[model samples]
Every structure is written in structure tokens, then in C-alpha cells.
Target: MSPELSFSGLSVLVARVAPHTVATVHALLRDGARVTVASSLDDLPTSLRDLAERGLVTLDPRADPTAHDVVLRGDPSTSPAPQPQPRVAPGSPDVGTVTLLGGGLGDPGLLTVAGIEAIRVADVIVHDRLAPLSALRHARDDVQVVDVGKIPRGDFTPQERINEILVEHALAGRNVLRLKGGDNFVFGRGGEEAEACTAHGIPVVVIPGLSSSIAAPALAGIPVTHRTLVQGFTVVSGHVPPGDPRSTLDWGAIARSRTTIVVLMGVATLGAIAETLVAEGLPATTPAAVVADAGLPSMRTARAALGEIDATARREGLGAPAVVVIGEVAALDVLR
Candidate 1:
């Protein structure tokens, strides 16, 4: 294919290749980049041998293990051949499909293999504020990104509007991906989206994401459940206060159960929830931890007794998009 955009000054080197990544390389060739294809960067052409030393480019030049699945794009003297793509099935017209992908906890690298595939093929992506940003960089340049992120008390997008966007795009024969933070069904309102798609006769596909309730704590070195200590665990949404009539959680049962308690979206009501648990028989000395930005560089964790967790959270200024663990496991800091 002829070059559409010129990467005239750019130099690209691809190493340890995979068959699927070849298409991206072909794209680079079409863009007019001076690309060098080698099994390893160590064996670069004599002219570009010092490329690594010049420090012109490096996503992470430190030490990329000689083996990885990333496909890099570049160009050469001749146009690169396009890789073969799957054929469209006969009689099955290409209809609009909505894929709900889990963006993982905070770290972009945590996105699942299937989630990456969905992003690469999507025509439009409607993402949440907490969605893994690193995963979005792999999307094709032409892909449309729609921000429908809902912050706690800040800018918010109504759910109906999000559903409308998905349905409207699918009706137009475009593949839309609703990328969300954590598992789509784990308080993600994914079921409602599926229902909307089904009501409108649109095909909906859901891809599970890593929920913060479990992954966040683990990233902060506190497992929600332990082999010998915790036989089971319970995850609850803490958006409502214990005394609120609108709340449906059974605090009494939760306090009586032996399972670990993992709360999502409960930062605001932590104090009331903790007090209720203690009133309902949950010990005040139970171990607890509040972990924010679980897998990111700024990740912070504050651990204390259940009676003190609310204060610890206040002192640390920990905010939402965090995982709260209360039980014997939160006391353990094995990950450090």
C-alpha cells in the first residue's frame, strides 16, 4: 500500500515478532518510516547500531526481556505486504456489535488478552474515568474515543445517555466498545447495558474486567481471602449508609459471617459502616486496610484496626476507586 502519512524522520526497530503484529508493521511502512526488522535490537544494522545509545526513543529502554508479544510499526524502502485478515462469513451481514470490556484496576498492563483484542477491533470506544489508560494507546488512530466517565460528585454522565450512545452507534453499523473499570457486572451496571442492547435488537458481548474489590487489595499486598484464615469472602457496594432506608445490604448478617468483607465505592460511608459492623458483632479490633490506586506508581495503602480504619483513611486522604478490606487478611502486608 502507498504511504498515507509520512514518518520521514522516524526510525523504527521491531524485534522478536509475532505473526499477528505484522499488520501494524505494514501500516508503519505505508507511513514512510525507516524501519529495521531484526530478531533482536542488539543485531541492528551498522548504521542504526548506535540507535540505542543515542537515546532518541525508548518506551522503557531499561531491559525489555528479549521476549514479548508487542508488535511495532516501521517502514522500509519497499512497501510492506498487508497481512491476511479473517474473511466475513457468508449470509451474515456485518452488523453492529457492542463489546463491554473490563479495563482492569488502575494499571494499564492488567488489561486481559481478550480486552486488548476488543479495543484493536473497535470503531468507537466509550470509556470510564477509571479505565486503564495504557490499554487505550493500542487503539487504531481512526478509532473514536468517547469519555463518559462518572466521578463521585464531580462531572457525571447519566447511564441512559451511555446506553443511547451504544445503541445509536450499533444501529449505524459501527462496532462500539464500552470500556469500563473492573468487571462489568460487579456493580458496573453491565446488565443494564446488555438489556438495552437486547431491547433494541443489537448484539452485545461482555468481557470481564479485574474488579478493584479484590485486585486492588492484592496489589496493595492485602489479599481479600487467605487459604487457612478465610474460607470465603463477600463483596458489597458501600455507596449507601447503613441507616439509609434506601440501602438493602444486610449488615447484621454480614457482621455475623466469618467471611472477609470487601467494600467497593464505600469511602464516604466507611465510618458509619464500620460502626454498624461493630454494633452488629464484628469485632472493633478486626484488621482493615484502605488501598488507593492499587497498581499504579502512586499506589498508597493504610492499614489499621477496624476501629481505626476510618481515621486512617481520613488521615491518608484516600479516595474512591479504592478497595477496602476488613478481616484478618487486611492485617497481612505480604506483598512488600
Candidate 2:
């Protein structure tokens, strides 16, 4: 039988062969592998050398890959059952407030239990075009769903107008959900809406979602940062061409760094951005990748050197809402 263990107690030493287990234990100690116990666990450490222990560590492949708090997140015997969902808050239907919810990446599975609860309780949802539409199903039949998504050079919803709607509905004594595709603070213009609410003395709340900047690349098997592979990474918007005077990014400095670079909303200006990087002394041979339609079953990816990424994207027929990753780590498609 496998050894029983508790990360909290740290009383149990779970490891492998005498030498390897010792080393693994040391590393776990250094890295503080100990997790705050939410439930209780036993018989683990898949890296163990003992075949009997490995058998105990095995789990259903379809289950969540990793546990957050093993005590609360893992198997039924070790983890507690999910709690019953709460009903919508009283007086929620008519509250002068605006709530910003990050709809997460395009996948409905990415939505958190808390986020789903908030959606069900909301009076109205003013959503972005890129946000997953499936989440709206959680709303009540009486709840109003509004589309305020902005498209490139197409049916644009002015920021001022969105703010107006937020204020108007909120003042009318309704709880409004300003649902955006990714984290509200990350290029989602959530700051403007919050400011509008504050100026009007309206209550505001933010429920963060996963930003596509990192999620898109991650879903495509790209890590924003890797040990020894990337010392750091930079994330920026590529919506505006580098040549444009209005562009505020310091392309020169960006090219000088070896840190990974992640560009969101820049597939259109990718050619110009690549040209600027090469001009600023970044090697034209730098690895780069484009991940399109991220979080969807139809997602696609194209890879090439920075010098050839634009051509690669063209060949792939990739479009906007894609993430462009450039750096030494871009080539690291570990999941592939």
C-alpha cells in the first residue's frame, strides 16, 4: 500500500528512491511545495520509484489535471463535495451598481464558479463581442442581455456610449454586468467604466477573467515564462503600427531585451512590428508564433522566425483577436 500523506502536516515524507526522493524532498522544501490544506490527501507522489506507490498516485485522466488545494480540490474521499449554490442576493434586481466580469478566454469551461453565480444574479449584462456567448445562458429569463462589443473598423460601440448605458441603467436602480472577454483591467477599457461609475457615485465591482494575452498563447502550448528559457516577458498591444507617432510603446527598448514578448490585437500591424524589431537590432531569426481563435475548438497556430512571421500568418490566413508571441520561448511548444 502507498504511504498516507498530508502536505499541511509535512509530517509525512513522500519521495522516491533513496537518492532521488531525498533530492525531490529538498527541492520541494526549497520551493515550499506545501499547500494550504483545504481538505486532506493521502498516497501520492507519482514520481516515486516504488511501483506500488505509483499505482496509488494514478488518477482518472479526465479529471482536473492538478489540484489547487488538494484537500478541497481532489478526489471525493479526500476532497469535500461542492457546496450548494446560493440564491441571488436580495435587492439585487434594483441596485445602482455596475459590475465588471472577465468572461475568461473564449471557453465556457474557463468561467469560474463565482463568475457563473454572478451572471445568474445580474439584472443586465452588457457584453463584448469576443466574450463567450454560452455563459449568458446562466442569466435569468427576465434578465436583459445587451451587446456592446466593438469590432475593428466595423460596428463600433463608442466608449462614451457604453459608459452612458452603464450609468443610465445603474441610476435606474438595476445591477448591471459589464462583461468583457478577458480581464477587465487588461485592455478591456474597464478603467473608463469604473471611473464613470465613481464620478456618478455608483457602486462598482470587478470580477476578473483570464486575459487572452496569456491564455491564448498558453492554450497553444506556449509558456509566457520558463525557467532558464525566459528571464522575463513583456506584454503589449499591437493594435497601432509602430511607425505611427501616436504609438506609445518603446519598440527600441523592447527589441533590446531578451525577455519574451507577447503582443495582443496586433496581427494587423504584425508586419510593421516585426520590421521595427529587426531594425532596432533584434535578430531577424528570433522565434515567433501566432495563435488564432484561441479557446475555441477551431483554434490554429503558425510559427516562424520574426522575419517570416508576417508571411506565415498570411499563409495561415490568420485574423484579428489572435496573440503574437515573439522571443526565444516562442519556439517552445512543449505541449505539442
Candidate 3:
């Protein structure tokens, strides 16, 4: 007989039908072992047949064990009893929490597992226009997916309204997932949203995602920094909001510095940016490249001299969701 088998907790034995001898030898008669056989009904051994008659085992006559299970039916004792998990009670402050998820560089594959899980469990999702739609496929069928995408000089839901929506959903006992493109903390205004949730005493979680600032240029075969080519890199937002006191950036110094410049959301200001750099003594001939829809299959990149960057990008018709890399490393693409 097989050695006394102790399954510690209630456990079921699931086996294929092809191995008849192995199933029969252990058929509900091993040393103090509660064995169950799953094989063809006609192939069951006498011992197994007797066990079935005595209720020690059950024969699933309707099942084709050759194709799936053959002999044993569901184990009465071994079947685990459904146990409820403890969760926040209704009306609890954290009962319906909000999660701020970073969708990562426009590539659904780049999303972290935690971000995917949050989407799957979310009662509602407020996503930016640039976030990959493929990432939302895992969500429940009835999930409420909202588009809060922002466009320049275009219709958009105000940030305050978006914040209110998040809070309203949580207060109504619904989980909310606020999904944004790229790293939430990296110019995505994720910090501001978190502050809003905290101010309302709503529980919140944040997931980091890949940033386009570095990924975009790298995908275009341009390294942001190299031991000999460029020592360091700096990421700056090209967007300047109206009436903002801290709108000014030292473009002259940035242009003259040795560090490579990676600008996000700068497509609209390319001409002025190029002009400023040239005026600041950076050579007009300095190599520069712009990559749009980085990390996506439909990505487009263009290379040009500092003086002709604006025209080159325009001629190529590169749109938003692009990153601009400026430095000697940008020239390496010409060699290939």
C-alpha cells in the first residue's frame, strides 16, 4: 500500500484517465488514505467499484474520463468551503478607495501588474486620452470608463471637476481608478490629484510607470547620457501655463550647458526653443531629434540640426505625445 498520505487540509486528487494502473492501485484503499480515482468508467478496478458502492468514492458515469475525468466525482470532504474575506464595511472612510495608476509610455505591455489589477477591480476608471486603450480590456464589462483627456485649445474636463468625480465615486461606495500616461509624479499632475484625495480623507494608492522623457529618445537609438558623449541629462516640461509666475526657464543656460536636454510636450514651442538655443551660443548645427508616440508600434522620429528642427518636425508632421532630445548623441543616428 502507498505510505500514509496526509493532505494536511481537505484536498482533492485530480488525475488523468490514461494512467489506469496508477489510479486503480491507489483507489480509495491506500494506507489510511482517502484516494479518489478519475478514469474511464469501464476501466475501474473491482476495488474502486466496491469503494463507489460503499460511498467511499463516486463514479461520474456521465463524464468521459478519457477526455477529462473518468472515475471519481467531486470530493465531498475535500471541497474547500467558501470563506469570505474581511473588507472595509459600508460607510467606512476607506470602504471605497481611489487608486492613481500610471499607464506608462503609451505601451500597454509596459503597465505593471499592480496597475492591471487595479483596473480589473475598479468600478470606474478616469483615463487620459493618451493612455493605451488596450490596458483597459481587463476591466469588468460593466465598469464605467470615463475619458478626461486634455487637449490644447480644445474641450476638456477641468481638473477640479475630475477631482470631484473621483471623490464622489468613492463616497458612493465605488472603487475609482485614475489612470494617466507616463509617471504620475512626472509632470502628469498625479501629485495634485493625490493631494485632493487626502484632503477629503479618501484612501489612495499610486503606481509608477515608465516616463517618455527617457524612453522616447532611447527608442530612437539615441542614449540620453553616455560616458564620453554626454555626461548627464535633464528633463523639463515645455508647457508654460498662462499667468504663472514661475513660467520662466533659463533656456540660455540650458542651451549652453553640456547636459543633454529632453523636453516633454514641447512640440508647439519647437521654433522658439530652437531660436533661443541658437541665440544662447549653442551652435545652430547641433544635432537634435524628436520622437512621437514613443514605444508604440506606430512611432515616428525625425532628426535635424538645431536651426532646422522646427521645420523638419513640421515637414514630418509630428504631433503631440513627443519628446525632443538635444545633444551630440542625437547625431549618432545619422551614422546608421
Can you give the TM-score per candidate against the true fold? 0.73, 0.72, 0.70
- Leading candidate by TM-score: 1
Residue 255 accuracy (lDDT) in model 1 = 90
- Local error of candidate 3 at residue 183 (angstroms): 0.8
Encode model 1's per-residue lDDT on 1-336: one tens digit a residue.
Answer: 233545554665564333222333434433445445554445432212222222222323333444433324333213233322343332235558899998877566788899999988988888776776546556765666676777676556799999999887777677899998898999999999999988877888988998888898888777777898998899999999898999999999999899999999998999999999999999999999888767654468888999999999989888775778999999898866
Across 210-230, the per-residue lDDT of candidate 2 in tens digits comes to 999889989988898999798
In model 2, what lDDT does residue 50 have?
20
- TM-score, candidate 1, is 0.73
Off by over 4 Å in 1: 1-94
Give the range where candidate 3 is weakest over 10 consecutive residues by summed lDDT.
Answer: 18-27
- In order, candidate lDDTs are 0.73, 0.71, 0.70
**lDDT of candidate 3 over 1-336, digit per residue (tens):** 122444322223444332123222232232223444455445653334433443444454344444532234432123233232344444576557889998887667788999989988988888775665546656665666666777554546799999988877776677889988888889988888888877777788998888888877877888898888889998888875212366677887787788999889888888878888788888999999999878655478999998998899999888776899888988775325
In terms of lDDT, model 1 sits at: 0.73
**Which clashing pairs does model 3 show?**
39-70, 39-71, 65-69, 65-70
